[model samples]
Target chain A: MKKLLIALLVSTFSFSAMADGHAEWWKKAGAPYAGTVIQGVAENTPPGQFAGEVLAKDFEKLTGIKVQLENTSWDQMYDKAIKDMEANSGIYDFVYIEQDIVYSYLDRDFLVNITQSLKDQPELVAPMVNMDDFTTFIDYFKDGSGDVFGMPMEAFVKVYLYRKDLFGAADAKSGFQKKYGYPLAPATSFAQWRDNAEFFTGYCAEKGMECWGTTVQGHTGHPASTYEFLESIGPSFGLYNWGVTDDFHSCVEGGGSLNGARAKAALTFWTSMLEFAPPESLQSTWSEVASTFAAGRAAQGWVYGENAAWIASNEEKSVVVGNVGVMQPPTAPGVMTQAAAGEGYIGYFDGGAYGIPHSSKNKEATLLWLQYIAQSEVQADWAVAGARITHYSTYDDPKVAAMDQIADGYFTLMQNTGYLYAGAPMYPFHAAGRAAIDPFTYAALAGEMSPSDALDGACEALDKVMKDLGYQN
Target chain B: MNSSKTAWLLLSPTIVILIIVGLLPFLYVLYVGFFNWMPLGKNKEMEFINFGYNYRELVFDKFFIDSVWRSIRFAIVTLALELTLGFLLALSLLSSFPLKAFFRSVHTLPLVIAPIVVGAIFKLFLVQGLGPIPFLAKELFGFKLNYMSSEAQAFWTIVVMDVWHWTPFVTLTLLAGLSALPQDPYESAKIDGANNFQIFIYITIPMLVPVLIVVIFIRMMDSLKIVDEVWMLTAGGPGYSTRFTGIHIWKEVFEKRTYGYGSAMSVLYLYITIVICWILYSVMVSRGKANEDE
Candidate 1:
């Protein structure tokens, strides 16, 4: 009887605590729109843990709509989004999707179509959200036909995160030019970038200093980071600049095969430089990469812009936060490839976009949620507080502008330089292709197979896939 | 009539479960295997292709053939290792020892943990650079051992992890078989002054053959269809060094979105598993019949 009482007391207290956590969003309306919204985000940050408080208090006070945010890790959020959408689980009212999986949702029509949804909820979209600012963003998704699919929320981006102290140690300016006939500044092309990283990291490693020059994400399964790294280096080679001539009617899709000399050469240049990365990079998974970079192990980590927020929060790991450099990714040593005239990589595919599922019964409410988030005010606030990349006409808020990291005009640099690769959307089934590449490609590099043989083997396997799907002409 | 009614009622749930969970899905996979399919129905161009194309490609594709070979190799390697380790463990465990019950329960720990869990733990321990196993290798042995990064090492590491997880299964089964052995032959051998090794080889060996054959058969059948561990640990990676048929088929199902193609690959995989298992079963059964006649 005594034991039962103790157990009962514990259960009651825990249950009430959970209820308070969940129901805190159900506050009395002091504003026009006074309902609670269930928002889901990845567990990487604290917003989700303190969801009932942070989002609810600010959101309700500002918009009169109470937001109930549930946080799970970024990886869990990606998996859950798929399951919830496929099964029409609706467990989450508004899920926070990792930017990488946005394409999966876009391809499957599992997310809310914010472009259309914004029309219905003017109160949500009113003076705060600027439609005019999203012209570039809209035209990015608009193919020949002017249909828009997604509204950008947050972006995980690559900045040439280098060490200033290293720069400080060396004869910073004139010494670099004398050593390598180039100006000592942020690398504008892929070739110079590679050479610099190799020079520093490789040279350091040889000296038995335990420190290498450069690092980035290259986990066996973390393809997203790998793709990002490849793209950063790709542009300097003019790789992403070329598309299979947009005249699809005249040409076969993916006409520019990965097996092409240019692609292989680009990959070779990329792979050969692995000597500069940490030995443990092969096992450094996504979180490990972030923490490693935060731990400041590598001299330069291919880092995301949002890492600024993370660096700010975690004091123990980051030694030089204000001194940390932020800019567009470096070019490969010899990649002079420019985007065919207008075929620029304006939007790299790494931002969250809303999509409406066919299974959704409450499309209106869902649309309202989408429009509300896409508003300029929200986008600006997301940048300042959420520390997220805004898709709304670039936020002009002084709060975001004051960020010393972005003060070097990195956003502007990327805005001007970045390209939207006309690559196939990263759908779920791309997993097979991803799975196939690692073992065979690495083997090729390791002298098991020639590059041509690797391509042939991989292509033949893919051909079988095509044939299995009856995709032969 | 009442007895018959009771039997039918008692057996109905199993029958229903078999249909719902097993037979129907198995048959459906076979049906889906006959055509081209997409998950979201967007690729109208790829909609109606026949199964003939799939068969032709599978027959021709070297990667598919290689993947099949890998899966078969994996199963054979794991089975041999499991039986050897398990048999030895069974011998030791058959006798009473300190903490016998606790140790026996510990032997089944891997069995209780999910295959995915085993994969995760091993991945953490075996992953190149970050894993502790490599640290131990470098510090203690002074070897540049990459259990996962290198192709051959990746395959061997997976095999070793599997052996660790599954050998206990064989041991527990073999222990049970050893425990069930009759004492008459041992008693006669003891009276005749037959030594331990000689008596064991002549008496315990032939008697436990049937149970061992059955155990081998069961383990072989399950090992061939293993997807979760291979997928979780490596996803057949370090450049397809670990790419098994299980990884191939699952990729088709989840990543490729070609449900029909995935179904077809699964059907082909299933066919191979069944044929191999059937051959083993036939040998075991015929051996049993021969023993019975003897």
Candidate 2:
């Protein structure tokens, strides 16, 4: 009898605690949709792992709806989700909408109009959850009519991460200075970046260190290498939107700037720097680049901010923990000014959102699940765990702010210098366009083709693909 | 029930399954092939063009043609190596040995592994810096080796990985055939004072032809549709040097959402596989007749 009484008291207290803050509204509004099992799929990244392990459980407890989040590999997730939707299989209630893929998904009408769904069912919208609270990254998932189709779960910009220890060492810095005849520091321009690449590589080689000046995401056999060139490196040199103009013209022919002098120059510069990179650079993906940098194999590289926190702080995986620094990527001369005029972005802003699929049977339940994730109280923990934050106010969370010292002020750079970054171009033929141009970019990296020839071939192919897709004549 | 009616009832389940799972999908593909089918989005509708547009697009698609040729190349190379190596291994194992059972079991290990798992294992083994292969090559040979960076390296790496994974399968099949062979012919050949090589050529090869035909057909069909192993390794990359027909069709159907065009590719791939099978069938028939004539 005493045990039963204690159990009752425990249950009552737990209920009251859950009903105190944003949880109260969720519990009340979600009651009608209780016991509905909703399924979601996402890539097996840090954020996906967090959602699968933590948020999925928390959501079930708060809403009485079972959430099954399957974290699949990058390609498999896209394949499964798209197949499920195409078949009208109703297999996935929610899917991870990558920022780059929004154009393709929207073009296909594969997503539910989440904004309209929220407005239609006002009670499902938690009080703390507001459309305005999210950063402009949410705009990536919005259609031209301004109706959002997904809830932004993670947002991060690609940034230049360098080894602070290497730069701080007196001998190393002086040695770099002696070679380059400039004060050795984080690069401010492309010329300095190249000089630093050469100097540090030569320095490390001369010293017999097991390191290179920089790691390269130049995997010749994969699309990732091509992505690095077009998104991170090309944009810095004023190549915007895959070097294609809005009117479907190549930059080289003075249509938009894709194969233009600056873009071609950027491509050449990007590929040429591979020489100073580690031997593994030719086969390195983004993950390998991060690992190489963390293992102290490279002095610097353009690392996706998603990897910044763990690489800078995780002691088990990162040898250079607490010894990393983040900065904006170096740009070509006058490119920064052009970027300021909104002509280009510094680097790719890479992240994904949880979207309700059109094939979902339990739309209301899924909406509640999305709203539960968007709550301000829940943002801080998820941000710290996933190294990504969607809400504008998440930066002010003490836990996130504390991570500043660890991530080398990555969070601060993202928020203050957010304008300089952009998500993938909103092309309807996003993946197809990528496929069309990737091989040429890859050929250039493999020394099979000159940068100019590669760009020209890529531009020609893009024109053909665009025309084939009914985008152009 | 009458005997005929009962027989029909027993086979009904299989027939129904065949119609639903097999015939329906093929017919659907044929039907969809006539239209410009975009399987998703606002333009998610099939527009009828009488199959002209899709076939024309496919015919002119250099990527698809290149992928087909690459797949054939991989098939021919791996098939030749596996058959040769497997035959040699089977012959060596035929004679009584001290650890014959242990050796036989070990040889069949690769057959049991999933292709995707093989791909993952090889990826860990071959990745330039992270993999031990490169580290060892650099330390022992005083030269760095990268298997996934260069176009040629990637193609050969996938080929080697496929051979390693599948050669054991061929060896085990041939071993089973050897075990099932009649001893009368071998004993007769031995009594005739025929050498081991002469016996193998005259008796064993002829007897194993039918089994060889089956094994060859299975491997040929599977190799033509290879995707998972190569995808996990190179993903038809480094400028499409290792791109296979299966991966190309997959990209079209799933990634590009070009349902009609992908169906056309699939149908074309099916026709090509069938034609190759027919040619192999004729060769097998000719070889069997030759053996019977002897």
Candidate 3:
């Protein structure tokens, strides 16, 4: 009975204190929506898991609203969110909007305009939830007329991660120099990347180390293959957004350059890298690629920033905990200059936001939830947990700054060169376009089709789809 | 009159459910197959058009045709292997033997597991480097087997997993049929001084025709709808080499959200399945009737 009394006292004191701060504003503004149940659908990524399982608890405590965050796989997340919104079922109040799919969602008018929403109800906007604090990733979810449609939650870029220990070894460095007549370091160009892959793969084989030169996400039959090609590899080779032209044509007959010489060359180079990757490369996705590198079976690979922190610091899960290095992906001759000039992207800038669906029954409640997540104070803990941060202020936080050493300069690289980043194209038919390319890309990886042929086939299909969708004459 | 009215009342709920759940949605699918319906796009409402558009697009679609062919080929391969292996296992278990009941129980275990679970289990077992099966193959045979990577190997791997999981079901069905066979024909054949092999061929083979037909019919239907294993395993890739029609339709409907095209494909698939089933039934029945007459 004494313990129970203490628990009740603590709860009362905490609520009274919380009801005094910025949360006090929420406690007042959320008077009508309190105790209402709202739900969100999100993938099982680091940031998503933290938001769903951890932050949702704090959100309910602060606002007296119940939140159910359904954490699931990527496929199921998309299926459930899209199906519910399309059916106008009002099942989900908030949906995680991937950076790549922002175009599709905005084009469909499926998301509520948060800027307009906040304007209409100024009281609902908490002082701590300032939109100006977010990074430029917020632009990915904005309309042409400058209406903000979503709150940027997580933002990350793909980087070339290498084994510092292997590169720093005296013997390996001297041997690489002897064989390739260059210093062994992180690759700065595609040619150098290939050379390093070859040298390391052969060296590992000679030593019977069971390690490969690099890892590739070249799953022969999944959408990951298409993603790796269009987002990561093609951008480095100076072909962006599957090489679709401004008018959205993808074939020569339609006056587009999707199957142009540069694209074919990029596809060729990407497929060639598969030879030096592990045998599992043919069946590996991003998750497997990360695992392969973390297992110390690969010397270097382009892995998502989300995995960098855990792979570099978590000893129980990763073998090369301390010996990790990060850098921007290698670019072709003039591509780096263009990318640096902000004319194009050199690598994949991947992230997502949370937006309220128009079909949501609890729009006001969901808005409060979004605002709660948008606070800069909540960002530091989320960044530490997920290795993702969208608020520019979170970068200055001492705790987040300390993660640089463990993440091997991941944040530093992202800060220094993140402007030269890109993501999926602004296409409403994004999924359809990917479906058209995935088969041929997988076939190319499997050596069933030549790179040029695969590009030709993919573009031809895309052209037909574009015409069918009335994108072109 | 009271009894007839009671029977009508009893059937009304089932009729209502069928109309609500089954028939209505089916009609809706047919209606949506014409024109464009972008549920989440600027065109939130449906735009009606002539039916020729969806059909024309599908008719020339090489990808759709390839998926259909792949599904049929997988169905045929699985059916052939399951029938042969199932028949052999059933024949062997016909004789009284040690631990017969234990073997029977063990053989039925795979049938109890879900197809998706089987797929997930084999996905792990077939991982290129870390999987135990690949590790053992390398250690024992001095050769590598990358099942889920190579095109032919992945396709055959899925087939092998299915055969392993479902062949026991066929064996059980055949075993029950074999147990129920009459013994008078075999006795007369033995009394006429025919050898054991002749008696078995003339009596057992002729008597099991009806049971074999039933088993084949059931197996054909199930194997043709092979979606879960492939979806879990390769997802019809390395270049659509294993993409059956069902996966194609699923991607179209769910991933691409091309409901109009997907519904058209569904209708076409339904028609094709019905035609093929009818043909198979006619052939099998005619063959059985001819054998019985002979």
Candidate 4:
């Protein structure tokens, strides 16, 4: 009996050790690391952008590993990161990611999913690994499947910024309701959103305030980044019912098809909404738009409440700093409010992720670095600096909670606004659609092509791209 | 015979560069185009059904045809406008002015600005409500010009923006050609008692024709691939009104992650550009030949 017990104990110990198929990358890359620099990709890094600065500082200090952080704008970075990995350029060690294209990368092993670490590592939890931190990450991070992608980085939910001075003035409020024949409040659906925009534009114009009713990105800008624009209204147009077919293959699944009427209607509404935008808005980017609204020219607009962090930080840059009103994307009639802000709406996955090129001799170092940043503590540090940190716990931390700015408004937006960025295996024609849509969008803004024509052209162009990409029909 | 090896050696570096940077990537594009290639597809060894499906879509896809049409129209219209304005400016510059150098340099200002920066600058001036230009339209003209809002306006803004950025390209080329003109013909015409109009028609214009044709050809090639200004300025919106072929293919390779298909589209677009270029070249050569015969 004694001999049997000894033998069993020995076998169990041996089996457990074997389960660790790879080295403890942290031990090899961080404090205990005895390797090369870890590579990381930082998309959405503007000059002096908060996330990039802190990441360069924190990742270095905490893990004691050098993170080769490549800072670039979101769209260009997305293109390069995908192209780099596709061409196998192992330039990144860690990456800034939105949920948008995460799935496709996960589905393809284009990235290393860290679910195993999540299940095994505890320090990665509490502040770092709070799965429920952001609503979309929780709902959309679908299981080990979500975990399999690089750890969630930042999440931004759509929030409304309105001219408090213009709308809140007692006379303007009552007068607006009387003129529009509706309560003067945040819009609920497509119709009200348009009415509100028109009212503001007309009022602002008459008042000679250089103000306009609403602002949305028709040009590819920040709103387009992380696919905030796609989920912003595309789903409200009935995308929830539209999805890829079962077996994760071709054909429509749940959401409406791209070629269908629902999408076309949404595209039309999108076009019509542009009528109120400022003239140069056709060329405006997200930062410029944010700056425009902050400068007190725009009366209403869809902005990520996290934007206030940028605004408040640069008071001299924004005239309306002390008076920016925050709200959520208006709901459209016949469209479920829930659909307008799905909890699982995620960012573009291609927004960022870390990968080892077949050329790298530093895979172990990269792995260790990934494990370190994936920790809750680092994520919390990120949130404090005003980035859309992926972890809920840090965002909801007592210190963060104490600060009413993000905890109350920005935090809530991240939590309850429902939309998460991740979806699909990366729409094959999304970028193509964006490119084709620019001129068509310009045309729509110009009232040259009706919204339907624009959508049809865009959709057709996208379909052609898809076909070019290898889609059968 | 003795110099054969030396000549081959002399050309080797360029040949190497052409293979590595130019011809190779293009050939690779054709090779990749045949496969249903995703940026993420190769490792998966995901077999794509291939039979010129991409080309088929390019020909038959309504979106593609529309984009091609829009892109073509945009290029043609923009070129005509830019050329007309550019030639006029060149003509004006040749006549002599107090600040000719300064004006010529200022015209190149838009060219020096990065396209993204130009996009930003124009965004301020062209967006609907706040722009000085729109304000002028509303106040001075009593017309609400939502140039950035309407599709027609938005599409034209791109044309205008391109004109701003590249009219100099045409102007500068013409100016250089004009400056290099032989003064003898115009002097002879003037001595023959020719009026300004007659002198311009017989002497000045004919001399500038070859250069104008060259300028047009160069602009055609450049316009076909004009991505940055259009991309940064409109991103191809208020709803896809001003999108171009370059924008289309770029989206395919980068945004869609459909590397194989994007490459195929690019290859086809490239082929079109090459064919168009070839035709232009042949026509120009034939025209030159006819001129020589005359």
Candidate 5:
């Protein structure tokens, strides 16, 4: 009885001590800016929604600082933040700087260096916030002098997701083997991927099911289609940076491979897969493709990692819960070796970081808020809620380890093979480059032009845009 | 003060407001359009190129030129269809039957709804598998109705959406005009033993020309600058088939951040609109003068 009483008392004291530590830290660091209201804007993805809805409220309650985070669509978020920064309106205290656009933000000197800010004002720095706790993904948000600009909030790779129930079925295994002269499994090569797609499409049709072999993020209008091709599919075909050279040339005559044989082959392969995709493929963006897979309309597809946790576990939102499997995307010959050697990537590592804009009126308070979110204590829950991990320690959290099982080892694969994935190329003209190449991509998808003709036109357009931007003579 | 001074004083507030909100911004855009200015990037300073550089680029920019032509085409087709259907609707409403009030109320509902809402509604209605249009198409005719399947289908779908949205406004305008028409011409036609078609061609058509001109002018301008509904629906897709001038300029300014080029495009678009309106105004005045002379 004495031992039990002692144990209860000790546990109570420990819990209170932890709570007091957090309270005292906030009481000290956030006192001067207690009444300050910081505003931010981000794309309304899972992570962004979590930060806005959950973390903002928590931070306000603890620190007495109001955080008004606007979660908007991708286009509107970029437009609003960029316009605000350009006008120096100080409307937003912080903005979501996506991985691909950070280079441009750095070039324009739009973001405040967070590392320098914290160092220059040590009193505002929370003792618990340490930069070393973050994963290598933070490296993407650093400027040329290695000064950290944006604080890494969410990092994830686009991964291959397949319906395990369909692939593991006895009937499907025997049928696939008989038809393709191999054992049924997740695709490991482009030929195998096509065979699997064709077989499943036919098999499901014969079974009188409303299912397609794959989900294609091939929206003819949105930039998501261009991203899918250049970042996801093109890399798998041994093409990178849309086949543009480091010297800012994109056409074959300018010694670039954007219109080379490999690019044409990649385009053809991507377009041919449409036949095996759902009827909504032509209208499918990233979100639509995730929903299609969750609704059981697709058997396999490349899906953003943020949606993987829910699709594999959340029964209310996903019919494929407990039946989803994830793996690295199938790559062409030598691509895997190159990726292993850090020479190229096999797929897209897509995420974003929150950065304080130089025009922000409340930079110190915003820095504290960023540090609060970046604490190792909050990362595990954030990862589980958003299916994104930015801190290296988050991978070892007990909750995350448990979730890895439910997510079919998605987190584990990300941790193990993340080096093989890469973010968008370091280009200050990312949006311009994508815009120049997008119309041809849409035309090819809509059958208005052949793949060869589309790439040829796209390369020429890209070259012209680069030259006009003074990147080339 | 004298009566003329009072009149000018009353109009001064409105004129000042217009100058501040409209003319000033227009002037600024004109100034900006002469430079090569990108708000973001290392080379963001406003560099003055020649006055003709932007205009020359516009002439050779096949995408921009094609989008402008598409807008014109959309305006012509939609205006023609809306006017014909609206006239029919107005004539039918003139002689009411059962549930006429309900029909009128329902017809105006589309106009009352926001353009983005209309786009969202049609997008949900036409989506494959999830939407009812494709399901019904399959169930009723065994035909798969995928709007995003082809450029023509996507473009026509947008046209249909525009016609549905604005046709009611056109009907209401024409109805008001029809209600105000004089009875003398019709009585003269009936006394001369004229048929309905002949009377419509001669008396009604001649008398309604002014209202018809107004309706055409309004619809032409609105149709040519369409962005919201079409943006929400197709997003100028199925391979740039429906990329109108407004969408093109929006992409340039907002998406691509080519503010100078976008301003130039806007300037050109405004000039075109003004020229077109002037021609219509000239025709209306000349027609009125001829009638007055008679």
Candidate 6:
């Protein structure tokens, strides 16, 4: 009787202490801004959805701050946030800053320096929020002084997704070997990719199956086509930063290779794949391509990593759920070496971060909300929910590791080879550059101009845009 | 207070609101049009450009000019088709028929739907592999019909969509006009042994000219400023074939963030539209007067 009473008392005290320890940091950090409300805006992507629906609720429960996150379409999110910021309306406390646009945000001085803010307000800093917990992707959100401006919520690389069921079929293996003198496999080079595209298209046709070789995200009227060519396809052919040199020029005369022979070849290769792609390729964007792959319409293609998790595991939305395979994007010879050496990248690493706007009125409260989300404890579930990772620890989390198996090692591949991928170059003129080159890219895809002529025209247009923007004399 | 003072007091709020919302923005845009001002980045500093600079850039911008021409073409084509179709529809509904009220109500359904929703409906109906139209085309006709596969097809698809959505508005307006037509002229024509075709060509068309002018003016203005449906459909693609002036200006102002240049373009576009409407009004007035003299 005496021992039982003593054990109960000891366990009770330990439980209370653990509970107190868990609540202590939040209570102290959140006491000042307990009832404050902060608003944020983000695109309605999977990651954004997770942050808005799950993480926001969790943060609010821990801290007394009310977080209202507006998840909207990609275009509308940018449009609303930019309009608000431009007008200094202070409508959004924090906004989603895409990796591609962070440079522009930094140049405009539109975001608060979170590192500096935490340093300045040491009282508000949470013990769990350490900068080293985040992956090197945090560097992408930093300004020139290496002070973090945005808190990365999601980071992913574009990858080559192939249908393992199709590639591993016995008949396909035998026929590909007979025809190409090699075993059927995921492509390792552009020529092999073309061969695979050709073989699978014919093979599917012969079997009377409603399948295609690949999905070409070549919407002639949308920006997706430009992204596929310039960011994904162009980089594989050794064309980086839209072939623009450090001097902000894209033409050969100005020492840029935008219209160089390799760029022309890259365009030709991409345009040629249209023949083997579904007829809807001309109208397809990134979303459509993912649907096409999920429907088992394409054998292989470059797919965004955001969709990889669901496409590989969700049987309801995906027909080839367990059959999806991922690999590094095929690159030209020596291009891989260059990317590995940090000289360039093979494909796009796309993601976004949440940044408190300079115009935000509730900066201190919003800062606490951000740090709450940034805690290492919240990341594993977020990564599983969104197929994104911003911390090294997320890869080791048992949930993520289990998901990695179901996703055919997508998470593992991202962790192992993510350095080979790069985000958009740091250009404050990102939109201007894309707008200038979009017309030519569209024309080339529509077969209105030859690949060479299209690149030549695009180079000239980019040069003119740079000049108009006062970047050059 | 006297009657005038009371009226002024009542009207002051509306006038003040108008100045604050409408007049002030217009004046601000006009002022901004002559400067090289960017709202963000290092270019946020406002630099005063010569007035001719923006106008010159506008003149030389082939894409903007092409988009303007496309808008003009779209306006003319949709107006012609809508006027003809709506007039025919109104004429058909003139006499009493079975379920006449039901037919009229059902015909006006498209008009009440928002333009963006209409675009989405059409997009769902025509999208390849998923849409029923392509499926039916392949299954029934033994050939695929992908509307977005070609530039001509996409352009015409937009035209057809606009005509389908707005023709009901025209028909309803004309139906009201036709209902209110003086019966004395028709009776006189019948007594004079006029045929149906003759009656329609002479009395019907002549008397309906006023309503037709109203319809034309309204649709012409609306179609010139068309953006939402087209944007939802193509986003001005297939090599800028459907990039109308509204979209062009929107891209400049919003997407590219060239505020001053977009302002210049908008001002010029507004001025041109006013001039065109004025000329059209003058021509119609003269024509009406000439008919009166005759």
Most accurate candidate by DockQ: 5
Model 6 regions more than 4 Å off: A1-20, B1-10, B40-42
Tell me how each candidate scores on DockQ against the true complex: 0.38, 0.44, 0.51, 0.34, 0.62, 0.52
Best by lDDT: 5
**Weakest lDDT window of 10 consecutive positions for candidate 2 chain B:** B36-45
By DockQ thresholds, what CAPRI class is model 5? medium
Candidate 5 stretches with Cα past 4 Å from truth are A1-19, B40-42, B283-294
In model 6 chain A, the worst 10-residue window by lDDT is A15-24
The alpha-carbon lDDT assigned to residue B132 of candidate 1 equals 92
Q: What is the lDDT of residue A28 in candidate 2?
A: 81
Pairs of residues at least 3 apart in sequence or in different chains that clash in candidate 6: none
Order of the predicted models by lDDT, top scorer first? 5, 6, 3, 2, 4, 1
Chain B TM-score, one value per candidate, order as shown: 0.89, 0.92, 0.91, 0.87, 0.94, 0.93
* Model 2 regions lying over 4 Å from their true place: A1-19, A205-209, A251-256, B1-8, B39-44, B190-193
lDDT of 4 by residue, A1-473 (tens): 99989988997777456423222433323555533576655665332144456654555654566666666776766766666666666665555544555545555556554556445654433232334444344334344534544544555555667766777778678877898787777676667778878888888777778777777665432225223335555655654312233222222232225435665676677667667866545545566677778778777776654455555445667778656666655554555534445533322221233444333445555655554455554555455555354565665665555443622365655555434333434443344434433444445445567656655554555444444444433
Question: In model 1, which runs have C-alpha deviations exceeding 4 angstroms?
Answer: A1-112, A117-127, A138-148, A170-210, A241-257, A285-287, A316-320, A332-349, A384-387, A391-395, A406-473, B39-42, B45-53, B99-102, B192-194, B288-294
Native contacts conserved, per model: 0.36, 0.53, 0.55, 0.52, 0.53, 0.40
| Model 1, span A280-352: residue lDDT tens | 6665554565566566556665655555555534456665554556665644433324343543442233444
Candidate 1 overall Cα lDDT vs. reference?
0.59
| Model 3 bad stretches (over 4 Å) | A1-20, B1-8, B38-45, B195-197
Residue-by-residue lDDT tens digits, candidate 2, A9-37: 99878756855866667788878988999
Residue B180 Cα positional deviation in candidate 4, in Å, after optimal superposition:
4.5
RMSD of each: 9.2, 5.1, 4.9, 8.6, 2.4, 3.6
Instruction: Give the lDDT of residue A345 in candidate 3.
Output: 79
